[model samples]
Target: MNGVIAGISYRSLLGRRRIWLLVVLPLVLIGLAVLLRAVGNGSEATTVTLMEKFALGTMLPLLGLIAGTGVIAPEIDDGTIVHLLAKPISRPVIARTKFLVAASMLALFAAVPTFVAAYLLVNLESDIAYGFALGAGVGGVAYAAVFMLLGILTRHAVTIGIAYALIWEGVVGNFVPGARRFSIQQWAQTVADQVSSSPFLSTEITIGFAATALLLVTVGAVLWAGRRLRSFSLTGDE
Candidate 1:
């Protein structure tokens, strides 16, 4: 919400070496879509599989980790966050600003590319493209909030986030019915299912559950991060 904080956060996030990581995933996603299209494998099933498995499952989490952590982690790690904390600005505003930066990064790097790739693979014949795109955008925001809280909570945000994304989301959520209720990916997929009439794109999670969970997680993580920031000590203790 604070423009100055948002500007500094943007520069901090984009100026880092991990910016390449942000660029790579989207490129790989679009490239995969192109390859599948060329091979005539752009069936609804294939499109849904790719979008669900690769785009929402893999790329969204990784991009979220990068953007979410990159916004504030490095500053915290290097002890430069003290400079910002010393400002008269409210701690919540700082947290919210960095969150907005991370969310915007997801919108650009995760959501937009998802739409483009889905469109490339399936076009407008069905709502799959729009469905997946919106799902990804909303999911990316939730991921950003969660991972941002993780960044504030620990220095190993990326490591823990990777494990959560790959193991919990990719493996467990897919196979375990109960676990799917807690998964951001599954909730997002449910959103996609509601939007797209394609039978290939569906989830065990209902739309009501998905909407409620997404809203709760996103808001809860952001508010928690703000509270943590408010009490954060310059010595790196909360």
Candidate 2:
């Protein structure tokens, strides 16, 4: 299992295409931040809001979906995943390794940039920058796990992921209080709520509980996807 994981991780790291996507996506987000900072002579509050609502809110989730899908869908589409399945490695192990890879990619592409962008936009007074970045980082991990599982379980993973991230979570979660309670992004915001000193900026959800629940749900989703992948039957294109 370890050998299979190592092989997959190493291959993913060395792959030019994969590495390029990881590097490019985060850089783009950071670049956008820089561009906004350069152009605007706005107040600090304006900058922070822009970074939070735009960068953290939009870019992070989208990047997670892309990275998660990229990690597994290519292998399945090309039928190279059978090579990993044919080994002594259990399907669960392979699924886990793939999920880890996807999560790592999301962290690199979404989370780190989000933090850096926040820092660039806001002062070091409160932990506002840190909190928003932390929230984005956690959300990135959960999003990656869920979307990676979607990739393994269905060919329509990208479409479904986009709909959930954009429509269900992005739109509904923002408008509906109840939906926010169920949202990964909202849970992440709870983390920011604790770190940031501003009462108005604080999340409605409690930080500690949200963090625990987020971790459990993410792990559960990964495990469920692994079990599902084990019995997944790949039929030839009709």
Candidate 3:
């Protein structure tokens, strides 16, 4: 059931008209990173900051939101999901498959581009490239789960995600110290900070414990979304 649903969702994503827009976002981020390097910043410090702030902070969340919401929202919107539900396949299977496609897409869009961007901008001797990429990858996992559930639970998932990603994480996190702890961006930055040779380029969080918690939340959210999807009533009159 899971395999069939996943296959269908994968094909649906591939057939999307604006799917190429998702591909463009990461490429543009990486291009800007390379351009920043090409311009020859005064120091590597600027490059690292650019990689941390623009690549991880900005690009990852936006890409996650788009990939996450795009996966299921259209089906629900067009009423095609009812056709899938009419089958013997369980709703949980359907949800999980959709999430798998969403999460995989988010990871590819967010993490791989980040690694390429890092390599373009910096030459850290430590495993900074791999570490930040891993952190960003995990961050994408969490975002995909959360936003996918949001897509199921509300009609306003995109708005909520945008508000949370841009207003809460980006704006509030910058101005308020306490808000930083609540941010996906902060958690991801903590992971990146651990890998960078210049720890001063980023701030550290308890990566060992934080990564564990993030993974748990992500998995739990995905499971909860599947359960929610199972119970979702698609009939308009209901």
Candidate 4:
């Protein structure tokens, strides 16, 4: 993708009021981490549980929803997509550019804070801080791709993404043992298990399976988004 499109995507991502929506969680997470540090509670078990529940379970998915759709949906809704579609660049490039911007923003907003929070809480084990950070980054990329595809496939991308992430993955997947097999949080947790020394951290799938699934889902979603964008209809709506 060209620099112009990438720049446009970046501005579209962080410039709007929607960017504020993305900011709240990271602020909360960092604030909570600070409070935990102030309280002198550095239990590794608590760190594992908190990171799993908040960073992976909640913030990552929500950030995914905002970042993924923020780059594309507003254009589609307001009819600006037509102009971009008429440009010389290929649809795949546009889609890839948007995905990269969204993924990068998600990493900045969610993943980096996760690592800093881990450090604040004195997580000095096997670089579990870095491990969870990497997992957060991976989840951001995967979720951004998937939700951007959903943005193209459905107008209610944010609603459906939230439902899948919060209700399905957060609630149902937690209660329904088999559902965890397909959850992104579970996959990320598997990656976290690799570089972390927290025994309490566990995942339903093996690291190999989780990594492969994460890769397939990310790549497949990006390809699907590009294909959809290639044939995206403007019609009289423009």
How high is each candidate's TM-score?
0.98, 0.86, 0.90, 0.96
For candidate 2, what's the RMSD? 2.8
Candidate 2 TM-score versus the reference: 0.86
State the lDDT at 141 in candidate 4: 93
Writing each residue's lDDT as its tens digit, candidate 1 over 74-187 gives 889999898889889999889899899999999999989999998998896579999999999999999999999999999998899999999998999989989999999999
lDDT (C-alpha, whole model) for all candidates: 0.92, 0.73, 0.76, 0.86
Tens digits of per-residue lDDT for model 3, 50-111: 66677767888887888788878777888877777777877777777777888888777788
Q: Residue 219: error of model 3 in Å?
A: 1.8
Q: What is the lDDT of candidate 3?
A: 0.76
Better of 2 and 3 by lDDT: 3
Alpha carbon lDDT at 112, candidate 2? 73
User: How do the residues 118-199 of candidate 2 rate in per-residue lDDT, one tens digit apiece?
Assistant: 6665655477777777787788888878878788778898889889878877799878988888888788778877777754
Ranking the candidates on lDDT from highest down gives 1, 4, 3, 2
Poorest 10 consecutive residues of model 3 by lDDT? 229-238
Name the regions of candidate 4 deviating beyond 4 angstroms. Answer: 236-238
Clashing pairs in 1: none
